[model samples]
Target: METRPLDVLNRGRDKRIVIILKNEKEITGKLQAFDIHLNMWLSDAEVSDSEVTKKYGKLLVRGDNIVCASPE
Candidate 1:
């Protein structure tokens, strides 16, 4: 069987994940949903940079803004 990136993400559902955006923002949260475009929905989300951290109950991240994602 071939292993794919999305496959890895699928397996990571309901787990904590960290997303790095093109703008250099980092977000950490629980994975709730995602799509082929890499657009994602996250719960208990936190967005952070060198200066500050903000929290949200839910977050929608556009695929185009995402540089990478990994387990937290």
Candidate 2:
């Protein structure tokens, strides 16, 4: 498997992860912070065009909202 930032997203803080959110939106950024609701705080996010349409930000993503992740 390809190790990218997203892969480590579920691992917790201080870890790198690339998050692929719902609506086929991919965000490649560090896991700066998160909450109990699975909402993430990211930095250096390389979001996809689809995400732009959804108005992505600090990323209030829910666990079920996530499609996949990688460690980059």
The 0-to-1 C-alpha lDDT of every candidate, in the order given, reads 0.93, 0.62
lDDT of 2 by residue, 1-72 (tens): 637544444565655677777877776666777654556777655667542633343554466777766655
Shift in Å, residue 49, candidate 2? 4.3
* Shift of residue 18 alpha carbon in model 1, Å: 0.5
Q: Write the per-residue lDDT of candidate 1 for residues 1-72, one digit (tens) a residue.
A: 637778888888999999999999999999999999999999999999999999999999999899999974
Candidate 2: clashing residue pairs, number: 16
Backbone clashes, candidate 1: 0
TM-score of each: 0.93, 0.54
lDDT of 2 at 62: 63
